[model samples]
Each structure stands twice: as structure tokens, then as C-alpha cells.
Target: MSDAYVALEGGSVVAARCRAPGTSHGELVFTTAYTGYEESLTDPSYEEQVLTFSYPLIGNYGVRSERFESGRVHPRAVVARELTDDVAEWLTEEGVPAVDRLDTRDLVGEIREGGAMKCGVSAGPDASPEDAKAALAECPGMSDYTDIGAQVSVSAQKTYPGDGDADTEVALVDCGAKESIVKSLVERGATVHVLPYDVSPGEVSDLAPDVLFISNGPGDPANFEAAESLVSEFVGEVPLAGICLGQQIIARALGGSTAKMDFGHRGVNQPVRDLRSEKVVMTTQNHGYTVADPGDLEVTQVNVNDDTPEGLESDDLRVLTRQYHPEANPGPNDTLGFFDDVLDMVDCRTPVAAD
Candidate 1:
């Protein structure tokens, strides 16, 4: 077998061979999760960046076809410390390519020292590691990530099956959204209409939904000018809820601010505490940006590790959001009730059976 070239900055190999060609680059970040590699790759929040796995071994358990959050692989690049030849049987079933391996410790050290930089991974002997590293180093950072939601958002409208005869209708804005979030709304007896990320509030208002939902996605929320306005207009006029990128957008609408994290939280076991209930919940998280300073929005939940804002609410507008995934698939179930809370906020009363 021929050797693959990997790009490194400050001695860390941030990109490896076989990543998608002609892809834009950004700072490479690392995630410590031992599992959920599939979910991580498809997450929109990693839109402009490459990802490095801190776990020593990857592709051991392999990829699952049934576990995809989005329609395609969305990461700019994926780097691992070691690659296993004996990929799991599930990977063969799924038909996803095995990730190229590189020196992860070196990559981690580079990101830690340099703070983060754009990088790429590709295959072939002609792929020069030095050239790729230099190209990536010169590329811009997270500022470009602002436009990521528009790039990855659904191009057309869509819908999902819900419980029979549901009274509540929900209009969900897809910002590179995951299917599970739609499933949660459906299970709660809601008729869901999925729209593109750039849809305006007036467009969604035409749907006459009882509640508006902003799904988690990739990129910086500040760049979504229309979305910010739409969300802001809908606040108080109708019930609203959001997660991940959606969360940040809602905060922005409510006069809050978001900032890029030092390293970002990407795992299935991140712990968050509910300031309202004073309960700690382990959650699935995948995002490079977070609410920098929640100016007017009331902070409801906070990360236990770094005290970063995890959840926020504007009671006056009936708007609520979370920086982490409450619909975690391969992660914890502690925050699942948060979805129920969303339904309740929208005043979707449960029907009482005849006595």
C-alpha cells in the first residue's frame, strides 16, 4: 500500500489523505468522544473545520448506516491517531469510507498552541503534506463559518410523519438539522413542516404553526441575517425553541452574544446543570461556537465543566434554547424532557380522555 500524506501545523498533523477534494478549510479542532463518530461527522456545527479524534483507536467499532444525522458526511476533514485495517462489519454494511490516520498527538499539540487553523486531508502521492499545511495555515478561521448554515441547509421544504390527528403544528427551520429532533417533535403529537434555513419569519408564519422550532446546524449564527430577523420577529408573537446553532441564533435575537469556544465541546457525555431545577444532566454535544455572553436572555442551564452557558430562555417571548443536544441519540436521556418543556411553552395542551 502507498503511504498517505498528512498536513500538520506546529508539529500536529491536522489533515490526512482521502478527505473530500475542493473543500474549503478552517481551523482544525479535536473531540474526545470515544463513540458517535458518525454523528460528529454529519453535525452541521463542524461545517468549516476539520476534526481530530483524541481517542487513540478509531474505526474499530465502525460506522452504522442507520445512525446518520444528516444526508451526507459534512466534516471538512477527519483525522485519527491510528486507523484499523479490521474495520467493523457495520462499516461494510453502511458503505462509508474508512478515515485516514495521522499523528493525533501532534495535531492536538498544534491546535493547542496555535489556537486553531484551517486544514485539509486528501489522498495520493502527489498530495504534499507541506503544501497542504501551508495552504491551510493561510486560510481564514471561524469568521467564514457564519455562512455555513446557508451552504448546508435543505434546499427545499419537507415534512415528517407525526402522531395521528395531532392538533399542534410546528414549523421547523432546518439549519443542517438532524432527523432525530424532528422525530422528537412528531412523537410529541405535533405536525411538523421542515423548511430551509434561510426561510423568513413571514414564510413560516404562513404555515400557521403553533410553535416555531430552529434546529441545530453548522456555522456561525451571526451570518444568518434573515434567520436572526425571522426568529426575532417570531419571538413573543409565537412560541419558539432551538438547539445548538439554533440556540445561539435565538440568543442573538434576544440581545445575547455568541463566541467561539477555546477547543469546543464534542462528545456524548458532557455534563450540564439546569439552573432552574439544579439538576445535572449528561448530554451529547457537537459545536465549535457557543453563547459568548447572554446579555438579556436568562441563562437556564450551564456547563458543569467550564461554566459556559448551556441553555437560555426569554420568558417574556416564550423562547428557549440549549447549547447542547437534548435529543441525543447515542448519548444521555436526561434532557429529553426539555423537548416536552418546549411543547408546554407553546400551550399545546394534552387532550383529556372522556371520563
Candidate 2:
């Protein structure tokens, strides 16, 4: 007999095995990535969401703390066809709900047809369909979580010294940054100062950083007014860079508009093409919003599948942004050069002709 019940927005209740006991609610979304379960689970971008693994078996390689992106699991709950004991135990210890032994293929199909929607999960020996439905009824939509940044970002400023000589300084506004992003910059000889999401412009000006970076985060871009304000404040003054939601925030601050995607890209092998060179590369992505209008920035690259803006750059303003993750924790290393491009902007203070 099933010990877990999942209530979807459409009124359908799916019975599943209880891997970890708890009750939770969030927006239900799926990821097609076949590996990197550990990194994906810890990603701050998964905040306020129920993550469903499209792959059948998860935790084949067991779990390790070194593979974690953040200090804790970000997803409110997890759904899968089968979850190994290691992952299940980890989720239980983290106080996050986990349910498996369900027809994930069918559930994924439903999400594709209906888009990401509100979901509720009730798991444990005493779990009931009514319990899950009750959670679902009370669950707020993603946009309604106006204070989501506070849930994932750091409360105080922290700094990580660069690995080597530490030539450049980067002031990173941590909306919800991944540890890998810090490591990536440190490895590149950059001293990274991670600041709070709601930090003021005066606080940033105190640092006098060579580059102002906005880290990837969760929730609607419009909600991160502080990060957007930072973007506007330092647009022409400091070289700017961002990734994932960082890209969306930069666009919004510069008069660009962002809209919700039907089902945002959440996988390892998303193909992106450069408009200038027409070169293609696979990237890792996890976002529910897309840039609709680029405002003053020039579109440098786009997703091959839907032609959405994937890379936004402005040589004049020394601003660079990407809609995909270039840190390549669980994805391809194809876009690692993105960091190089962003760091290069430090030397290009004066505007140059678009190449």
C-alpha cells in the first residue's frame, strides 16, 4: 500500500512510496539531467519548488558533502521513480520530504502539457490524499513568494580570498549563489566579496570592486529590487556580469522586460548558439523566467531550441550576462569560457566596437 500522496494543481492525486516522511508544498518542476543529483539538490535555484527527476534511478553513486552546491537542500520536496537510501536518508535528515516509486514518466508528461504548477506532498505512514490536497490548497504561487531572496541568501557579508595572486576584486551580490561560483572566481585569481541580496549601493561603492556580479537566484526577477538597483547603480561605472537569474535581473534594471516561461529550461544539455559566430554549445540551466526585451543590451547568443536570449552583452557598458550556468558542476564545460569573457571586461573600461 502507498504511504505517500502527491496532490497536483489539476486535482489529481498520485500515490507514491514514502522515502522521507513530511508534508510540503511548492511549484512542481522536472529536470532531465541524468547525473549530478547531489549538486542539483543543493542548488539555491530550486528554492520553493518540488523537484522531479526525469531519470529513473537517482543516487546511484551515493552522496557526498563536497558535491553539494549549498549548505542545505533547496527544494521543498523531491519526486522520483526510485531514490536510493543515501539520498532518501539525506533528505530525511534535512527535513525535506521525498516520495518515489511513482510513474515519473507520466508525471513529467503532465507537467509538459500543463506547465509548472502548484503541488503538495504528504508522506509518512499516515499520509493521506486529503492531507496533500490541503497543503496544495494553501500553497502560494511562485510569484507570491516576494521574500524568497531572504530565504536563500546570506544575511551578512563574507569574503573568499583568491587561490593565487588575487589580481582582481569582485563584489558579488548573493541573491542565492552557488559555492561553485565562488570557487570558480577564486580559481581565476579573483577575491570575491559575497554581499547580501538586499545590500545598498553605498555598501557596494565602499568595496570599489573591479567587477560587480549578480549571482543566480530563485523567484521572479521583479522581486529582487535590490539586485536590480545595484545593476542600475554600477552599470557604466563598474564592469558587470551575471548568470541565470543574474542575467534576468541585469536586463530588468536596464529597461529590459522578463516574462515567465511555460516550463523553464532545467537540464544539463541545453544547446545555445552565438549569434555572431553561429557556434553552438551545450549548457546547464534552471530558470522559470526568460528575457522578453533586451532594452539597451545587445543579444550575443540564444537558445537553439526556442531562440530565447541566452547571452546578453554590451561592449560599451562593459556588461555581460548569460541565462545558463557556466560553472559546469553537473553540466558540460563548454561555457566555462564565459567567465573569461566576463573577467576580460575589467580591462575594457572604454567602449570598443562590437566584434
Candidate 3:
């Protein structure tokens, strides 16, 4: 075992064992997901964040390419109580920093208490904890840092043919979206034109899509001015939807507001109750900020644990949004009906995304 250290923004450091050697910076955060390490590692939502796993034992199942959420790893670093050999090798091969024998229980507790903070990790097997803490001064804090959505979003327009009969035409604003989000739509035969984060109203209107989708992405939703601009142009004129950061954008566009969570939800099993269904279903979620108040909008769902807004809708604007991931790649599909509801709004005669 080599040396590794997690440095907090407050200038404290935790000593640990280094599985991969490197120095990296990100917002110090944790995920409660016990499985799906591969999906979590590649999820665009984890971008620029040093992830701490609450599951004490990790990587026992080994790495599998089929489970990847994206083409590559997204988290800046990995921390855990025990890192398996397979995960360590994969992290080392990918040039990502990772550490084990790190007191993750204490780390998660601290983060939960203080909220996510800008931090750095150095995994040199003989790294100095103090040195890592000192370097934290140079790293950008998550709140002040911008450019997160742009970093993960698509830069060009690409169209994918629907796997179904191609009845519904959908325009998706790729604000750092996950692959499953598109797959969920395309599987139902919806022609999807994936656009960039800064896509103009003209570009979207040119598609003449029956539905407009704003996707989940990293960083603060406030940083995504262009997405908000697009929302302003299309709201009330088109059937629109958003997820995660997309949900936050809709809130802002509709006169509501977003606020950073004390510690954002990043996990596979979150319970949210649908106001319409009166049923609580498990969901997947990842976001540092949440809609504090969904102004003038009907609250659709609420997180059972925290009472935070999980879903919002505006029948007037024909828009619906969920702050959790309903496309669930590595999570349960209980809330997949949200997508079916969106497709229904698209006038899809058939119930889609039911799987």
C-alpha cells in the first residue's frame, strides 16, 4: 500500500492508502450507491468531483465495460474504506486517482455535516497530507467554479433514428446528458436530435419537435445561462421537459429558484412520492443544487426523506420536470413511468419508456 490523502477546503487532511498515484481536485462528495461503481464512475454528473463511496467494500464484482454510463470515467478521484484490486487496476489504467483504507465513514459524516467542499486528492503511496491540504488553496471552489455543463455537454448536433416507428420527433438539449436519457427516448421510436447546451431557439424551433428536453448536467444550474435562454424562448409554446439540472432551469425560467443542497443526493435508491399517483417509488438522483421553491408550478413529486421538490409541472406551459434521474442506468426502474408520461405529452399513442 502506498500513501494517499484527501484534503478538505477547510485545510484538514485525511491519511490513507494509495491505489493509484496522482493529484487531482474536485468538490468533495459521496455516493450511497452500493453497486454500479462503473456507472457511477462514468456518469457525467460526477464531473470534476472527488467521490467518496459510502459502501465500505467496493469493486468486488470487478470492472465491466458493458456497465459504463459514458465512454470514460468522470469522477476526479475515488475514496473508500476498502478498494478492491480490480477497481484499483482500472483506476490506475484510466489515470484516475483512488485511495482505500481511508476512513470513509468519518469522511462522509464530515461532508454531510459541512456540505460538499472543494478538495484535492494526492495518491502517491508516500504523499504528504499537509502538502495536499496546502494545494487545496489553488483549487476552485465548487460554488464559484463555472464551465461544468459545457465540459460534459455535446458540442455538435447529431441525430439518432428512433428504434420504433419514429412517430414523435424530439429535440434534446444535451446539457451533459447521460446516454440512457437518449436511449430511453429512441427506444420508443422517437427521432431525437441531440443539440448542444448553447443551442439557440432557432435551432430548436427548426426541428419542429413535438417535445423539447433539457438534460441533467454537472455544476450549478445558474451557470447555464444559455439553457435558460432556450427555455425562455420555448416555454408555454412547446411541450417541454427537464431532468436534474434541467429541472432547476425550468424552475428559474418560471420564476422559481434553486439553492445548493447541504449535501446533494447522489445514489441509486431515493424514495419520491408522486402527487398524482400517491405512491412512493425508488429513484436515482445526482445534483448539488435543487429547486428551493417551484413558483407558480404544481409540485408533482417530493423526496420522502427530505421533503425537497422532486418533480414539478406547469399545465399552462405544458412542461414537466423531475430533479431525479428517471432513465436509471444502474438504478431501479420504478420511476421510469416519468418518461412514459413525457412521451404521452408528445402525443405518443403508445405508452413508451415503460421498461
- The top-ranked prediction according to lDDT is 2
lDDT of 3 at 36: 85
Tell me each candidate's TM-score: 0.87, 0.98, 0.95
Q: What lDDT does candidate 3 reach at residue 278?
A: 92
Off by over 4 Å in 1: 8-24, 85-101, 348-355
Off by over 4 Å in 3: 348-355
lDDT (10s digit) by residue, model 2, range 1-355: 9999999999999999999999999999999999999999999999999999999999999999999999999999999999999999999999999999999999999999999999999999999999999999989989999989999999999999988875788899999999999989988989999999999988887877889999999999999998998899789988999999999999999999999998899999999999999999999999999999999999999999999999999988889999999999887999998877877887865321222
Ranking by lDDT: 2, 3, 1
Candidate 2 local Cα displacement, residue 50, angstroms: 0.2
Best candidate, TM-score: 2
Global fold similarity of model 1 (TM-score): 0.87
lDDT of 1 by residue, 39-117 (tens): 7766666676667788888767766657777776666555676655533233323333223555678667767767665
